[model samples]
Target: MSDTLIEAGKRTIELEAQAVKALGERIDGEFAKACEMILNCQHRVIVTGMGKSGHIGGKIAATLASTGTPAFFVHPGEASHGDLGMITQDDVVIAISNSGSSAEVITLLPLLKRMGNPLISMTGQNQSPLAKAAHAHLDISIEQEACPLNLAPTCSTTATLAMGDALAVALLEARGFTAKDFAFSHPGGALGRKLLLKVEDIMHSGNELPRVEKTALISEALMEMTAKGFGMTTVMDGQELLGVFTDGDLRRSLDQGIDFNTATMIDVMTAKPLTISQNRLAAEALGLMDAKKITALVVEDDQQQPVGLLHMHDLLKAGLV
Candidate 1:
């Protein structure tokens, strides 16, 4: 790399670090008050800002919405042109502006106040007009911009984004939010697949389950495993699981010169095989199978009755592995 590029990168890291470190000293009673106001709001959070601050506000709104807080972003420029109709008296507005004087955001203050909507300002300058008009002000001041020209909003925007994350996390904890709750908001993501997908959701049920009676001949069990295409079969005595017979067992039985027609499933099966609960996460079943070096498992219900069967192939197909 060229010396100029190396120096620029170093400067950028140093400036951004300083900005984030400075935020620690800025968090105080005002930060607490901002969180309290949003937590008590009866309506959704409406985030607004201009330019780079607006971009950061959009991300903040998404984070808040995904983490148990209902929030949306309204462009300040649009809010002035009838978009403000989206705001209501029950809503809390979080306005973002590094200088605390973005013209677009400032212009909405009067109408917001008139609507009796609570205002929370995230700004670099506490004395600025936007901060002064807000019900609560969160100081997101940075020492310097990471930009070489010191004109572009760099470190200031980074600090503002981090502060938004802090607020979202605090609210998430206060609301007792869980992974399941987060999964509901992000159903299309990998986290949702891992947390929300159950063994029953992916397991082979009914006619697809490879099963054979304990009294059945080894040949009958092998036929059941082959027909079901799971490479294994559960040996059950009525409702009780007696054991499991797999392709490996068949190979061993063949080498031992065992008569398939005479050998019962109980005689060739491995007793007390690993089993999973139907309510368990598919990811959990994958872990168990990996730990045991097994390809398939019988899924049991709350009463320990085998309800379904799962295989490594199933997990692979579901993209869980």
Candidate 2:
């Protein structure tokens, strides 16, 4: 029985994968025309569908919106009552249906035509009413369903999803959307945090930064480091960064039997320590620290003067790590 279930799962995956793969070949003049219509649309793209197709339409709308294309989803059933007002003559509508003849969707055709809005249809039946009425038709037909009974909307939904992804990605490339643009739409996600967060946003500023002059005694630097709780201190001369004294440096100095009261910070500090710019992304700082095998880095300005300090704990707290 276990072997039978495994085979059934494998067969379903194979069928769905093939269905999605076939979508690439279906892209031709019709797909191009659909993209052209959307790119030239002056208003938002309104996606409408019923049942399972509605779920897929919602996801496609979200993908388009996040990838630099302004879009939203409207249910076909709701459109008949009052939601149709959401769509204007300037907007473009994308209708999804497996049979291309959903009753609720077909009922809205006359009103949509009166409004003079262009229609883009995605359906399994190219000759169906919805496709026939559309300005452009994107065929999402599949050979068979992944379900053993062939009644579920498995393979067809997979093909439709793939087609939607292809359209979104094509539009994304044409619009020259960048990671920074995507971050603006998804500020709460991990990628957004990595792209939009900077060292200055989370770095230790003001009195939180431990600092001591090169002429200061090693004991004095250690006291400052302990007070700051950062396990390190920046050794500087006025506004210029000289080096850094860390816990590791103290351990090595202790092995040398040097008196903490007599030793200067310069004698125990590591010269030319790794530094990052305040404007740089915290993700980039994480990479630099990981590569250097260090826990902290000095944040500098354009002139290489230290302004703040960033620790690995900051990245963890920001959820960038």
Instruction: Quote each prediction's TM-score.
Output: 0.93, 0.92
Each prediction's whole-model lDDT (CA): 0.92, 0.94
**Best candidate per TM-score, number?**
1
**Of the candidates shown, which would achieve the greatest lDDT relative to the real structure?**
2
Clash totals in order: 0, 0
lDDT of 1: 0.92
- Name model 2 segments beyond 4 Å from true: none
In the predicted model 1, the residue pairs found to clash are none
Minimum summed lDDT over a 10-residue window in model 2 is located at 258-267
Among residues 3 or more apart in sequence or in different chains, the pairs in candidate 2 whose N, CA or C atoms overlap within 3 Å are none
